[model samples]
Target: MTSAFSLKRTLNLARWNAVLLTRNRLAFVYAVVLPVLPILIMLAGERGDPAVGATSITTVFLVVGLFPVYYNVLSQFVSRRDELVLKRMRTGETRDAEMIVSIALPGIVSALVISAVVVPLSQLFEQPLPVNPVLYAAAAVLAVIMFTAFAYWTAAWTRSAEAAQLTSMPIILLASLGPLGASLADSNETLARIIDATPGAAMNELVRVGWFGFDGAEATEKTLSFAETWSAAGPPLIVMAAWTIAACSLASRSMRWEPRS
Candidate 1:
């Protein structure tokens, strides 16, 4: 007979996994330091400036999703499988879904924590409170789903934890496209369209609309009212949703639970 789903057991495993993640100094840097660096840079040079506000927060949001959520999750799955931990766990009461969720939980929480802190912290730089906090919340939720799925999907080809460094480069470069999407639009509209269709650019759009109140890609004299934000969010939302679905599907198809020869 199958065991019933248990939230308590899942959380316990997640807690232990979190401890492991935090203990690694390099992982610690990815989880904490890299995500916050953009904000610190903005503060040191342009304290309380609104112009860079959305850029800074969006950078933190995207950075957190990439390293902690994406890279760490990829590394953990590879390392655990190589050590036979995943295979061993399967011999017991743990369900496959439960195990996967638990493995992805810590990075999800770290991403959320960074997202939450940035809202209040943005005020320190004299930026206004987010005009559409709901959009911010929505983006954060989608980010966790998308990036974590990306990690699992990427883990399929990763031979070992060390191999993760090379495997994760495409994702890193994908994320790097976020900040450059708008700039690219000016010179090469077609290339810019492709970038905008990507998950990172979709996130950048959401941040620009939700946090800074820009209307779509173009800034106007007035900030968008409450209702306009949702309309602006629609395209990016679709892009992110499509990517999320693709990632989850690929992860399920390709993930390996046992060590390689």
Candidate 2:
């Protein structure tokens, strides 16, 4: 009985949040546009190089998975807090976890949908299909979870909806560097090690391994066999898992249900 009620409330909250999201014209535009922008940019410069194709596919997937969580979920959380919506919701039957999940569902769903489209369409665009679908799926799921938790973490500091953009920039930059994980590994081993520990780099490394079997190292000239070994998949999975735990912990501790007065 309680479980059923919770599910109903969660679904209703998600639906309401989705409607609010679609009503925001600018955010709606971003939801529609940002997922495709990297693909278009990559496709435009695609020269049939397998290495480039692999990198492009990794970049597109990471961007699709991370950007929406940063831009949409974080902003919505801040906006709701500033407007006292979260405070009001808390006074009702909605639990904190449900509220967080409901608010994040729309952006997370958008990111997942884009990722689903990007993966297959990537092959059509002449990129290799994901050689390890399980690894790719795990990485993408972790990306969404980590980013959503980080969104809440950022919202703890963001003063208003206007501040969300600025607060989110640091994580955005960190995740944005993920696409360059391969090149960075080749050029500067120390820097590559540092970046690989981050969630963004984890996303790209997982994709690299899944698509090109190359674990974010210097791209080889020849096509490689699909390598889904524990050796290839373990490190990034650990990194993402650790980050997800830390982010969720911090967000739960620091999150403010009411506007800062």
Clashes of 1: 1
Predicted candidate 2 versus true structure: per-residue lDDT over 82-152, tens digit per residue: 88988998888888878888988888888887777877777666766667777767777788898898889
TM-score of candidate 2 against the unseen true structure: 0.90
Tens-place lDDT per residue, model 1, 1-261, is: 567778988999999998998899998888767887877755865665555787787788788889879998899899999999999999988888888899889888888988889888878777777788899899899988999999999999999999999999998888779788877787888898899898898988888888778775546323788789889889999999999999999999987899777
- Candidate 2 lDDT (Cα, whole model)? 0.76
Worst 10 residues of 2 by lDDT: 220-229
lDDT agreement with native, every candidate: 0.85, 0.76
Runs in model 2 with CA error above 4 Å? 1-5, 220-228
Error of 1 at 238 (Å): 0.4
- Check candidate 1 and list the clashing pairs: 48-125
